[model samples]
Target: MKKVICFLAVLITFVAAFQLFRQKEGVENESYTINLRHNKSYHDETDELIYKGLLWSFSQVGATLPKKTTARGIEKVTDTLWRIDVSKLGFRPVVLEKWRRIIAAAKNTQEYHLYGSIMLNRFVICSIYASNHYYEMVQAPKTYSEFLHPSVNASSKAEYAVEISSVSKGERLIRMDTTVEAITAQQFIAVEGSGHFSQGNFKEELFELIDMMPNGQLRYLIYSHNGRLVNASPNSYGDAGKPAKCMWCHESYLLDNFMSTPNIKGYLNYEQFVSLNKRNNDKLIKYRKQLSTEINYENKKDHELAEIMYISYMEPSAETLAFEWHLSIEEIRRHLAKLRTHQHHEFPFLGQLYDRHEVDKLAPHKSVPIPKSIREPNDDEPNLLGAN
Candidate 1:
């Protein structure tokens, strides 16, 4: 009788353990379901699922963009799917490639939704939860001047000022750090003045001096302020006595000409500067107009129509466009067909020319003409390092 009692007790304990394990697993699976019903950013069931999937994937890969980390990896799981892996120590390229394939084979964008992740300054990670709607804003190209220039006019003076008045006897200028990993894969880049500066004095003059450096080496100038060469960041080329070290990383990233003379941060804004020059501005003007149109279309009430316009003009991947707008691939394809009816010619799947063609049909006689001498900065131009 005692033996029977012992067996029964053991069985009960085992069942309890199994039940607990099952409950934990269920909770873990549902963990991504954020109750954003009351959140303003919420879209619909599809949008919610996209957000959940993106968040879950990010969590799984431990991708957090924190300043001063070792390496980070982002993989496009699909047009509407993505995963990121961030590490303090290192990363695995094979894992990134795996996610890339997974994303590629995923369902079309209409069936899924799109999301994007951007890592900035090795520290800041910004995720566009609703990428289909807002990816253009996130991915908009900016010139070095536009990237570093202050957003507000009032802040411009103080923002770009270099400290000269309050220099301590041995005030050390901190050398800027450059990592090959940090330079590559970033969508937008810029440079800004650092350290405390006297009121109303700007660093544009200093920037001009740095801009003149050979091989477009702008990173070399961050080592000094007020004629004193400060300490360089650890493991940096500056610390290694390689002032022109930026070339190595930039060249590898296919941005060797990013800092070429014509693309440097001149006295005028990019558009303004291009206007004054004798260069052909047709490409620049068209690119800017397209960006403007995308931004305008993002807020349209008829999301389906808005998406149709976007895909027709932008010609993004069907899956990617669908993911961005919370539609399926089939839905996007159907919209493309409708757009093709309006356009006499067959639309190219991926290119910028689609925007001009679509705009001509949709808004006849209303054109944003490129200025004669205005040229848009190349998309791959070197980004300026903004003031910390």
Candidate 2:
């Protein structure tokens, strides 16, 4: 009888231990999810786990694929690398095949699980893969007159010439167009004339984007002069994509800091540039007032998009974080040590990096009221803050 009792007790203990192990595993899995729903607060982590499975899926996929970029367009540069032409409005079979692998692997993450079907219908049905909705807008008209802005009727073309970029100080012609009916329909294209080329003599390394969504929130995109989506800007150093590089410097949707140099051959004089820009600015603000009924456009500054991308993708070092948050390195380290960490596919290969979702919760609101100052003063930025 005592032997029977002992056997029963052992079985009970084993079952309890098994249950405990499952509970612990569930908690660990939950920590890695990043909830990116638009309406939810940035601080809100308690929403139902919209994304499932381990974050390591992204790393696993990144390991298998060719490095993201090769040459600017669909140039068969190498055996493994092929560039995508954004203007074509469809992924080549080879490019689609590569992104298919990524999408299949990403199916487990929230990026795929929740958004996959939606983006697939929105972008995939249209033929773009591996990118967001704005990728479709690359094929949109490049010039202001081509877009047929209401203001363009008053002038044959709504292009305004500014000085050759005091920001980048590059000898490239810079022209801006901000003339669409509503803020959401607005688009901006700043072309860097043939004065500059990338390492391999790539020409016209300009930035183009449609700046707002239908809801009036900002969206930024970067494309090569050939009208292909590109990760790097010809003017900038690192290969930060889309809004990351663009938003890193812009505090507002439209920056009011285009200085004119009349002596420069192609650009408009100071007075003409200022007067036209103010009129453009006033119209954009009026459009935003129209959108205020449905969207809180002012809640997010353009620079926060940069910060979100930095935290998510960069796995920043202590020094970088210190500068970003206006905190000391030691303090940054302390905060990092407390947060949950993940193995980021891109970097911090030696060890796991802090999870951005958790890190975001620590400072529920913007850590600082003001935007971070530009780290490099003379970087090749032709447009200071451009809105569409």
Candidate 3:
């Protein structure tokens, strides 16, 4: 268990800067937090990464402008190419070509590739190639072990985070420690932020709260106003050491079952497949030669045509567009009102609390972009310390 201690003040990203500044303008300008832990700032917003490949991890994001990878749009990089490069992170003295292949398959895109034990520490490392694109950055995710099982059910986006506040004295920050781990080979990667914070930047006060973790017990957790909360435990991560029991399912849960659930039987791209020959011989054979092939040709074509027509031609008129415009105003207002009413009653979390306010003092809004998480983080040793 990794124990983490944190002390936090009213720390807001660039997102909240203006809201805080409007209250007291003309100051020399307040600095913001930009550490490796999960953070969100208007200046260092997320679309920048989503434009790169964020969906593999984060969900329910609402960037002011849909993140655009290129000048105009997004072109999702295909997963068919499992490209993993270990040198990107500079893993170790001992070479492991297999490890690099494992990470390449796991990078940015949300998916899992199981492998038998290869090393002692199981010190799995995830990659996020942070580059100077648009104006943004993101905390790097390590594995499917951390994905399916998260530390906390983030009210917003679940992120391993460090809440940092700019103080006159210096930089004050806090981190949420612990991540989920798999238990056995037959066991699936259970999701949980199960460890404790082993280290972090803290204030003597808010910092002491996490000192109670048992050495290796703390698991998947997420940062929240109170502190990081465990969203999952060992069982969800995999059949491992402790059978993490759930409070709600306490009647049948046990902590010792963790290590006994048995390693989950996973499939290779080959194992989970029915070779091209089995996908409807005639159809697949034909799809292989068409400009745009199809597995469920009829259904897919029907849906595609309707969807395209509706979006291309039948979409609401401008007046009915959410933004105040001239053409379909009333209809749009009615649709939005209905949407708001429906969302308020059912999807409050997905509703409009996403505020992308601007710092009027800053320059014209510019798009922020990020690079792939497959680059070498140690290409330049002099800048390595600063990179983190």
Report the number of the highest-lDDT candidate: 2
TM-score of each: 0.26, 0.41, 0.16
Cα lDDT tens digits, model 1, 176-196, are 112112221111222224332
Between prediction 2 and prediction 3, the one with superior TM-score is 2
Stretches of candidate 2 off by over 4 Å are 1-155, 158-169, 176-186, 196-207, 235-241, 258-266, 292-295, 299-313, 316-388
lDDT of residue 84 for candidate 1: 38
lDDT preference between candidates 1 and 3, better one: 1
Measured over all alpha carbons after superposition, the RMSD of each candidate to the real structure, in angstroms, is: 19.2, 18.3, 27.1
Question: What is the C-alpha RMSD, rounded to one decimal, of candidate 2?
Answer: 18.3
lDDT for each residue of candidate 3 in 1-388, tens digit (9 for 90 to 100): 1232222223435537876777453221111100111112112324333223222111101111222311221222232111222222222222223333333333212112112111100111121112211001122122333233243433422122212211112222222222222211011121223232234322321111111111111122122223322222212223211111121121111111211111222211222122311322333324323422111223322322212211211122222122212125455444344332222232233233211111111212221111111112222111111222
- Candidate 1: where is the Cα deviation over 4 Å? 33-190, 193-201, 204-257, 260-388
For the record, the alpha-carbon RMSD of candidate 1 to the native fold, in angstroms, is 19.2
Query: lDDT-based ranking, best first?
Result: 2, 1, 3
Where is the poorest 10-residue window by lDDT in model 3? 116-125
Candidate 1 minimal-lDDT segment of 10 residues: 119-128
For each of the candidates, give the backbone clash count: 24, 2, 64
Candidate 1: TM-score?
Answer: 0.26
